[model samples]
Target: MTDLPLHELAIERHIAAPVSHVYKIWMERLPEWWAPKPWTTEVVEMDARPGGRSAMNMVSPDGEVSPVEGVFLEIAPEQRIVFTDAFRAGWIPHPPFMTGIFAFAPDGEGTAYRAAARHWDEATMQSHSEMGFEAGWGAVADQFKALCEETWVAR
Candidate 1:
């Protein structure tokens, strides 16, 4: 059998907005389009720095809530961001999960955005895939694009 990568799902899209704008929304406007609406999201704490915390709650329509808490391993303004749920703030170890890297680069007048998820093993990768990684992350990306373009057009 072939070897499975330790990394999991990754998605990319070309968003018709500036790199800075795309980066800004990921942090500042996250809650607006974080979850596929009907299910909304809320930010609890986001210091947005290396070793800083990133916490949010995603609430379903029926009031079920799921919290995502993690730390920013790296933050390159308007360029890239790396965070992981494997550890909480202050470098405290938690249950090992997924690490994510979000990046934006100028593509023509817009930006090329990428969200890549890394897992510790094949099992974790498979679990995230089965959890609708594509559909869910894709939806949020679309929502983010619309929100950014709409706001840009309005300005």
Candidate 2:
């Protein structure tokens, strides 16, 4: 097998919520926690299946919209999701950026969550790191955990 993390950026967290619950919220309410505070996400489409399209707009506080379009490579419910910006829907090729891998596993009464972005090269990986990958992705993960825990309590 090839080394997957050679050009990867990742973040992990143990969320205080069940894997099922975390996955459910992640799938159904992505925009709620996708972007960090003051930045927002608007989902254009999210079809959670292999080859399905996943499009969204990340809106800045000043209303600048950064459109993101990708296709899902794999989706294992309550387990993992892998997607790539290399291809839009219908297998149409696009300029490649990175492939996103997110995994969810049961950890006692909580969930072990991991999110990774695999880049095509070291330059792109470095670029992503320079773009505040840690702070930004960490904030998103924290948001996700908080939402899951809060929602789990409200359930």
Candidate 3:
């Protein structure tokens, strides 16, 4: 199990799918389950490698778009992914809210998926928590689990 730092928030789920399938689905279909219901995600570009750029826009129901730009710090296929908004591609500095860490491991015939958000300070973590982090991340997890399980089972 990954240690939970003081400035971090995380959620975990056990999905009825293999780790490889879960990881592949997440990388290949990120825009589908990245956002909660009533809000959709659009992947502008994603280079799934260390130091690669990861960009996306989340569109609200009312058409408000929130763009996110980050760089991948690490990508261990079927194991883990780490990214941060602290910098853009080519190491350009940017205002960062948090660093994202996602891990996937095999649990029998399923996968143990963990998603974590690491903030720069406790205040930032608190702000994220107060912004419905639990509900939002939980909903996204459910969406992802359902998609991975359904897709894997159907194949």
Best candidate (score: TM-score): 2
The candidate 2 region of ten consecutive residues with least summed lDDT is 2-11
lDDT value for model 3: 0.96
Q: Write the per-residue lDDT of candidate 1 for residues 41-129, one digit (tens) a residue.
A: 98999988899999999999999999999999999999999999988888899997899999899999999999889999888888998
Q: Per-residue CA lDDT of candidate 2, range 1-155, in tens? A: 97565699999999999999999999999999999888999999999999999999999999999999999999999999999999989999999999999999999989999999999999999999999999999999999999999999998
> For all the candidates, what are their Cα RMSDs to the real structure?
2.7, 1.1, 2.2
Model 2 TM-score on a 0 to 1 scale: 0.97
Clashes of 2: 0
Instruction: Give candidate 3 regions above 4 Å deviation.
Output: 1-6
Answer with 1 or 2, whichever has the higher TM-score: 2
Pitting candidate 2 against candidate 3, the one with the higher TM-score is 2
What is the lDDT of every predicted structure here? 0.90, 0.95, 0.96
lDDT of 3 by residue, 36-149 (tens): 988999999899999999999999999999998999999999999999999999999998899999999999999999999999998999999999999999999999999999
- Which residue ranges in model 1 land beyond 4 Å of their true spot? 1-6
Clash counts per candidate, in order, are 0, 0, 0
How do the predictions measure up, each by TM-score? 0.94, 0.97, 0.95
